[model samples]
Target: MKKIIKTTLVLLITITTISCGNKSEKKEADSKKIEQTEEQQHSSSENSIQLNNGNPWMANIETTQGIANMKKLMDNFSKKENSEAYTQLKSSLEKEFGTIITACTMEGESHNQLHNYLVPMKDYFEGLASKDILKCKKTYNELNKHLAEYSTYFK
Candidate 1:
């Protein structure tokens, strides 16, 4: 009787442990599913910003054009090395570009998104205009990373 009782008790504990582990696993899987669902929803909303007439190539071209223009502006600022003027220029450019992105992302695909995306590129140039080259480089790299990430989502 003693032997039977001990075996039964051990079996009961084993079963209980197994059940608890299964519950925790289930909970983790459910949580992951919820997170994935939310990400999908957000992506869908962002993708709703259709390329003008569904032309991805044209959209890419437009985006490149704006980037090129901002690069040119940045080059000009670097040549001047005027910190105060560059700061003002950078601020205004950021504002204007932000407006364009907001308008494009809001609804109705517009040239505005391309414009806003250029703001950071302009910042990169303006940063070079400052005395602190390292700081400017860091900021420029960070901005580029953000733009790369944002572009991936749009694509």
Candidate 2:
């Protein structure tokens, strides 16, 4: 009787585990699908930065100031060679980003254009917090390039 009871319990546990695993697998697959869709959307041409009649787009004062502040933060951070300083720089940059978003007064196509340029910046900022110092350095260089590109696309 004890052997039968033990067998039954083991089978029940296995069945429950299998059922939960299937459900989680399905959920994970669904999540991947959504992420792919979003990635496609972001990568689309409409989200890309383009010039207005071959001239740089006019950026709002707040947005321009925020970018400048972030650039300054990056400059200071580059002088320091440590992960902790990079993390702090990331925090400061995020705060400046928040200020830009809060003070945004842009409208219509200009606003859309600004968003196209700004959306990918968050990913670069996220990379700054990486555990790998080499990754952080690469991200920093990419972020610097990204910031410099702002002038090319937006004045």
Candidate 3:
């Protein structure tokens, strides 16, 4: 009877050890799964920041080119000092800037991130129509500064 009781106690201990090991293995697996899920969420957020087609830098280059073209148009008007032509040119510039703002604002990714650049651009153009030559020149410089910073994000 003593020998039988000893054997039963040993068997119970072995069974408990095996059961505890399985529980520990299951806990480890659950922890790993949670970690993988978190990593996937992080990756998706990063992907969203990237432009569609995975070439966000290209958009920045294009935006810079557009700003350069606008500056050139403004320079020509400034050089000519033709009030009538300047008036029309200024109006066109405002419209183009408005379109750019609308497009940028409509974008899903990085819209808020880009608002600092776009808002100043809009404000500068809004004042262009009535600005004197000196004010226009100042605003042009300001616009160029903002565009330069904006372009750097792409680079």
Each model's RMSD to truth, in Å? 7.7, 8.3, 13.4
lDDT of each: 0.55, 0.87, 0.60
TM-score of 2: 0.71
**Candidate 2: lDDT of 81?**
62
Which residue pairs come into collision in candidate 3? none
Model 3 clash count equals 0
Worst 10 residues of 1 by lDDT: 56-65
Clashing pairs in 1: 97-116
lDDT per residue as tens, model 3, 57-152: 434444455566676665656543433444576677776665555554234445543543455566676545544766655666666666555445
* lDDT, candidate 2, 1-155, per-residue tens: 99999999999999999999999999999999999998899779778888888998888999999999988887776544687777777889899989989999988888888998889889988888887788888888998899889898888
* Range of the 10 consecutive residues with the lowest summed lDDT in candidate 3: 47-56
- Alpha-carbon error at 52 in model 2, in Å? 0.6
Which candidate should be chosen as best, given lDDT against the real structure?
A: 2
In model 1, the runs with Cα more than 4 Å from the true position are: 2-27, 30-50, 53-72, 79-89, 98-107, 111-132, 138-155
- Tell me model 1's lDDT, rounded to 2 decimals: 0.55
Assess the local accuracy of residue 50 in candidate 3 as a C-alpha lDDT between 0 and 100.
39
The alpha-carbon root-mean-square deviation between model 3 and the true structure, to one decimal in Å, is 13.4
By lDDT, highest first, what's the ranking?
Answer: 2, 3, 1
Cα distance off (Å), candidate 1, residue 98 = 5.5
Q: Give the TM-score of candidate 1.
A: 0.39
Better of 1 and 2 by TM-score: 2
lDDT of 1 by residue, 1-155 (tens): 99999999999999999999999999999999999999999966664433545443134543444444444444554423344654655665565455444544333344444444444466565664466646655655565565454443343
